[model samples]
Target: MEDKRNIQIIEWEHLDKKKFYVFGVAMTMMIRVSVYPFTLIRTRLQVQKGKSLYHGTFDAFIKILRADGVTGLYRGFLVNTFTLISGQCYVTTYELTRKFVADYSQSNTVKSLVAGGSASLVAQSITVPIDVVSQHLMMQRKGERMGRFQVRGSPEGRGVVAFGQTKDIIRQILRADGLRGFYRGYVASLLTYIPNSAVWWPFYHFYAEQISYLCPTECPHIVFQAVSGPLAAATASVLTNPMDVIRTRVQVEGKSSIILTFRQLMAEEGPWGLMKGLSARIISATPSSIVIVVGYESLKKLSLRPELVDSRHCYQRFTDCYKRLYQLQPEMTQRIYDKFITQLQTSVREEISEIKAEGNLEAVLNALDKIVEDRKDQEEPAWRPSGNPEADLRSALVPYFRQQRDALQRHVRKQEAENRRLAEAVVAGRQQVQELQRRGQARQQAWQALHREQKELVAVLGEPE
Candidate 1:
């Protein structure tokens, strides 16, 4: 009876594992569909620099909506969705292949690396054309000045002739350059996506294991999973960001060949040109990748076991608990979970304040402010060009210390001259006073002598001292 029960348990585990994959596939598809707008916006924002599109993510979205309406945001979504679905095929196949490799391999790390790299290569090769097209489609729009019917990449017509719509642009490409034009950046796409995607899962698993070991067994599963995904995604992003930048540029431009495009960018600005939007890419990719993987993993787990969801649990389920297999409203579940999390965060801040004494809190806040100010100063660029309007205005109004030094020198010279002049005037006035006194004395002496002469003459005739 005991032996039979153990066999049944093992069988049940196998069944659950199989069921989980099926559930995971559906959930991942839904998540990707939901986030397509974000993905599209992020890609476009990364590609276009010096244009209004480069302003920032939010601004780009707003512009797209205002210029093209709701449809503009999801411009290439059909291509994107199809490509994503195709890519997932590779992912699924790669997972199976990786499992086989891992099972047969002696070393876990080697197995992971090989499995990841091989899977990426295979998947990317299969989807490169689709990827390129999707990228271009996302970037395509009627240039803001162009009318709705104006096609981008239209034929060389007369001066200032209006362009056509996106579909028209597609038709033009087909007419002018054929299928090859639509798949222009296929090689670049493959080169970028394969290695980047390949390294991600391996690194993710490795870090996740490391974090799990560091954590106590009782530590929350969600915490480690959440932390590991971000760390792994960040590491992968930094390593592969240059490739992503190139891919985005190639896709956006719709060049005829990868080699020509590469040469063009290199000739224009050297190798650094390929990394134009690297900062924004990293900023967007790292966090988004983390959130995506973490969300996917958590959802995947729940879908495997719908019964694990418990609504009664205060913080764990209330805040973090997402429904596993609710057919009715998966998105609604996510919304509820997010709201609960917001509330919990608010409560945590309030609780911290309640626990800490007000006196000590003020000191902590001061320290925090100083730290924030230091970070802000570090983040700000050391210099902005004087040609910039803001910089020009600021420069004109605020005298630099160097200018202040020159002004001070001129002031000192003027002050010294005034002091010398005043000193000379004082000396001249004193000399005049002395001269007058001397003259008066001499005059008095003369008067005295005359008087004496008179006295002497008189003395001979009667004068006393």
Candidate 2:
């Protein structure tokens, strides 16, 4: 099989925009639903004062389950789901920005960082209002009899708000803070998520490139993404946890100033307070990153134009030709001939017709016959050619085959030399290990002899005289 790493990246220009958007939205929704409970848990953990209601993510899960049932975990999910609109905007902006930046910079890391930050800036406009409302809903407690869930900055007095009452939450925010209530944590959101996005993408690409280099050549693309996505997200989440804590507090508690929130949180809960929801955030982000990265890549692959897909397959065929050259399999040779003829027919139908009309077809056939006759005695044939254009073309391609054969032979020789060098190094390493073991044995024997002599000297000196 061809190494998929060699396949070209499916850029935004190559995608069917309509299909990409549709699939992207659907995938985003599905992933959001799957990881939403973690978001709710994280928000609850961040807003609660001094672990009053829930100690950590697992404890939060169990307590919420026991108190309010499964429905408790999905609180505010409906409002949060609206962020899929911003998710689409985020992707669109990221791709466009990355493409635009490509003309100026050659570095993938710089491109990703710029694109991610730009996307986050655009997305936060749509996301912050939703976050404000959903986080309010996230703080709502249904089963207050079990334990009062204390939120530090909650605008809704000390009373418990009913679950799924999005309208009431909106009304309360409007009546209390007016239109500005919807954007309570906008700055904090930008601070938290912009850097989060900016850091996440570059790290993701960097880790993926490193992993791809370290892994076997045949490793699948999806596996590389799965391993790299979570690692990048976890790193980003840890770095931005403090900002995230501040953002959640501002949105849920209706805090006015980011500076005030930070100072108060530190004064009340100390430095560790900034990491209140770190675990929940990491857990939530891991699968979310994996799904988003894998789904985005898959969407790009599935939405590629027909010609691009064909070109990709052609590239794979060219790479596979090296291996097939070594085996000289008749079936593989036939497939290659068929593929070549198909490409020729597709690409040069008009030229072929022009040749036939100009009465040059016979001359071309005679030239092909002459080439075949000249090569007839060169070597033993792998397969007899049927009388067809494909067969004739195959027989005429001896020079190309010879070139490929020479390159393959060189590669094999280089690999063999590397193997020999590695074998010699292994033998030398084993000899060094043996020498160390002998020295260790000698030291052990000397230490044992010295201990015995000391014991005799002590016994003789202490004889009851």
lDDT of 2 at 432: 100
> Compared with the true structure, what per-residue lDDT tens digits does model 2 show for residues 1-465?
456454344568888888888888888888888788889899888988897888899999998788667777887787888998999899899989989997897566888899899999999999998988887777767523221123332244323344436776777788888999899888888999999999998889888889989988778888888999999999999999999999888877778999999999999999999999899999989988898678777788888876777665654444344443424543344445456657777867887788899999999889878888888887533334453444454564665588789999999999999999999999999999999999999999999999999999999999997
Report the number of the highest-TM-score candidate.
2
Runs of candidate 1 with Cα error greater than 4 angstroms are 1-22, 49-53, 142-170, 213-217, 256-260, 266-273, 279-465
For model 1, what is the error of residue 384's alpha carbon versus the real structure, in angstroms, after optimal superposition?
74
Best by lDDT: 2
Listed in order, each prediction's TM-score against the native is 0.51, 0.66
CA RMSD per model (angstroms)? 28.3, 17.4
Q: Candidate 1 residues 1-465, lDDT tens each?
A: 011001000111222455555665676566556566667676775565434445666777687778667767666566556655555565466556656774576444565567666767666666666665556566656543221123453254211112234456566557756787666566666677667766776787777778877877567666666777767766776777666666666656655566676676677657665655544455545554655456554544454333433322332322122222122443333444446457667997996687484557767778768777777858443333443544443443255445778899999999999999999999999999999999999999999999999988977877455
